[model samples]
Target: MKKHIILSAILLLAAALLYCSGDRQQVGQVTLEWWQFWTDPAIKPTIEKIAADYEAANPNVKINLTDLTWADGHEKIVIAFSSGTAPDIIELGSDWVAEFSSAGQLADITEDVIKDTANFLGWSAGIWKDRIYARPWILGTRILFINRDLLRKAGLGENYVPINWDQLKEVCYKIDSLGKDIYGFGSNAAEKHRLYKKFLPFFWAADGRIVSLDGKYSVFASDKAYRALKFYKELSDSCSMVDTQRRLEDAFLEGKIGVIISGDWLLKRIKNENIQLDFVTTLIPGPKYPGKSFAGGEYLAVSAGSANKTEAARFMEFITNKDNQLLFCKANYSTNPSSKAATTDTFFTSDVNLQTFVKQMNMSEMVPATPQWVYVEDIIERMLEDVLFNDAPVAESLYEANHKIKELIFKE
Candidate 1:
């Protein structure tokens, strides 16, 4: 009888201890679910290390990272929000932020990030209706990558950099005259999501705006748009190889193409692989001088339905801070930190090629922050296809595209 009583008491004590331990864990611990799209084997380790460091600093906080792919991340995020199964934090592409912000699926983080706006770049990418819903993490811009050897062979000095459209045309034509196998310009083909990026810089250079600030109407059918399209079509036809961005970059690397508008990824590839190609980076030549290019990057946002909003916001801010951004950008090697101070570091300033990209990034612009931007970009791509491939009149294509975009924006 005594043995039975003692065993019962011990059992009760063990149960009580277990209960208290579980309760303590529940009270003191916080886990934040972060869904991100950095899946590269080389880069994922850096992300993991950063998360581990953050966890070590905050002992009670845990980061639950979920890797996502660009191919279907948007669709997964939409489903998560609709089902109320969204993670606490999400890494969104610059173009995807509007759809989530407009749907009220993203937490309003203006108060958390407003004071730091001056310290960071590309805030326009994260702001919706004057309210910031995300923090820009890494920024990137497209610049002109020129083959120095091709320029020299064409009788243009190896040091020559085209600063205006006329000079660029002359160089391109001179290079194209070299041979049938070698092209002058690497023009983007009818790629669904890509052709618009290549074409928008020209449109923007000509002072074209896609939609009004209020998002009430389309302002894309102006004389500037028509002129930009006509010029782009002429340039492409005269001395360019129409291909996908990947093929274009490959051609540039193989020294088969003279000039292409490419981003930092190609720069990193060349440097890392020690390619023995003679190339220089320059700002995209415009009608008069260097013009605006496309600026876009990764953004971090807190989910509106996340129970751990405060913790998620803290982690978001921490990861996007200057030091962390520099670390991540350095590891990625193909992106610029969103932090203004981070860019001033010797990592970027010491290299003339990187400096060109930084300069272009400052002059770059993002697409309009509208929820219907996906459809709008589709229309823009189709319009370019019509003019470039179908030989449709530039003005007629612009007018039709403008009408379609207006209907998409103001439809009842």
Candidate 2:
């Protein structure tokens, strides 16, 4: 009887100790919900590996990732915020940060991020009301992709590349004259959110401003904007086939299109598919010189409603560090790391084609940072469609767009 009691007591003590150990282990463990937009099969693994590595380093932290698509991600995020079920961290397009930050949906992270502005580019995309709400991650820019064979067949040497507005127009016309069902330019059609990006570069290259620096009014009705629109219409009507960006890229790949302005995603597709085509990328030709291209990027932001703000911020800082960002950028071939040090890696410095992108990115400009930009983008797209497709007068279209934008910005 004494032995039985002693054995039972020992087993009870052991069970109690194990239960306490398990309880203690759960005390400091954290699970974070992370929503991101990189859904490519080739790139998703790298993203998972990044999160896994972060978890391995910080054993008490866990990340649960949810993949989002560009098509529906914005709508889903808005719904999540409204339902009070937002994630701990979100990977937002650079254009979206301002909208969320200004609406109080994003956590203000100015003090949590690095103070060195030179270390990362595109900081303005993440700032709203002078407060930083996101960290720039992957940066990319659009450049002109030329079909070398088309240029040569058009009686221009392979070495011939457009350097200015007149040269570009002349080259495009020459290519169009080939008359074998080939197009000189791949112009974007009425893509609601996209046509504005294609059009704004021309506007900016012609020295157009959409709004004043104070964000108080629209300056989009200037002669520069009208001139830009007139030129765009001429180019589109003369030698271009208008289509969605995807169809345009497919046409470019099929050798039916001569020149197209596209970002690194196209580059990645070409390299990945091992397509055999002679082509080169160049900066967008300007009215007088090489013009500024549109700069776009991915950014990381903590959700204002996250329960684990500190842990979320730490994870963001970790993943955006030089080494991790370089890894991510390497896996995503056409993208540059936001980290300045990562760009110094031989991977970027050694490639001549990538150097073209680097040069263009240096001269690129982002759209204005404003919560009203979504409405403004829609208005501009409508204005372009009016002139480019509906035959609306360019000057009148600009006046209407400028008026609508002014109402959106200055309205009470």
Candidate 3:
């Protein structure tokens, strides 16, 4: 009751604030508080420049920007929304749209804006049950990074990359010169949420998805689920790779591993470290299916308690527009959700390697898009890791997971 009261007070306060802004045309003044996730230094200036441009066009409106980490942003937004002190605009993840929208803490953007304002991978990323709540920022799919230098010494070709599990296994088998100081693969498979992020593709490419479209159940206990876990085990055993996510990144960064699965974020580090590695990024592999991957991107939404909801949406629409998306992504070193931008831009289109990621995004599957997903995916990941590393029987582990998922869907 106290929480609801607080949220209500906030709503009233914001109503009054927006009311005040309405009369500001007399003085020609409006100011919006905006929040964004942390950016690469190169990208930060570009974003700030976007704000400057907007300010120039609308001299009466001022945007006050705040930077946040993903983890930090959640706590901050929750408190702000509860107290009616939330900013006018904020950045969010795709998975978060439903959670925030249902809380009555996000603006219902359906009638006011044309969602096609920006070209993105899939409009569905920010739309839930036919209502759009957020705008996408950056998008890119995961890929395999190989150290071509390591392959040659293992009697593999000077330039080699794996397209499937069998090929990856062959490379790992030949390249696991443990005593001679080499490992085949590595990943931060131990980071709880991240482990799932890294592994979702394996589950997806084998013709599996995390949740039913109705958002009611998990398929982790299904046969396809069994195959997904089984393949991870096989891949881990044969590749001589460690199960931890950072360990895998560290191994690849050190140039000790022949292959590692990573995203575009690693590009700068690979180039700067002078690792003598000719790495290529490609879709992850599968046996029963061609290797598909997961698509991850960020989105922006306005707080329901925000006083500047209308003005905030204007900024969201403007920033995500095709031309701005190009400027933002090119500076950010990541992909944007803008599908048209992605299809036509010389940056991604001209490069086969970069295009591979966009292709994988099309074939990708999303994680369960529920607040319960955090808990559900956590429970599912640990069970799969236990089976993969300890050789736990696939059927029993999957059974336990599927039953729990159903229980959770109701529980949530």
Cα lDDT for residue 152, candidate 2: 95
For model 1, what is the error of residue 386's alpha carbon versus the real structure, in angstroms, after optimal superposition? Answer: 0.8
Q: Whole-model lDDT, candidate 1?
A: 0.90
lDDT of 1 by residue, 230-261 (tens): 88888899999999999999998999999999
Candidate 3 lDDT (Cα, 0 to 1): 0.73
Lowest summed lDDT across 10 adjacent residues in model 1 is found at 328-337
Q: Write the per-residue lDDT of candidate 2 for residues 257-310, one digit (tens) a residue.
A: 899999888988899999888898898978989788888899999999998899
Candidate 2 wrong stretches, greater than 4 Å:
1-27
Candidate ranking under lDDT, highest first, comes to 1, 2, 3
Model 2 lDDT vs. the true structure?
0.88
Report model 3's TM-score to 2 decimal places: 0.86
- By TM-score, is 2 or 3 better? 2
lDDT of 3 by residue, 1-412 (tens): 9999999999999878876895657555778888888565877898898899999998988989999887677788778888888888888877776677777788878765664644355556666666777776666678777777778878888667677777877887777764456887774455666777766787777777666767665666678877777777776776656756666777777778887777776765555566565766666777633687777677888887776777888888788777777787677666434546555789878866667677777777666556566678778778867776667888998888778887877665
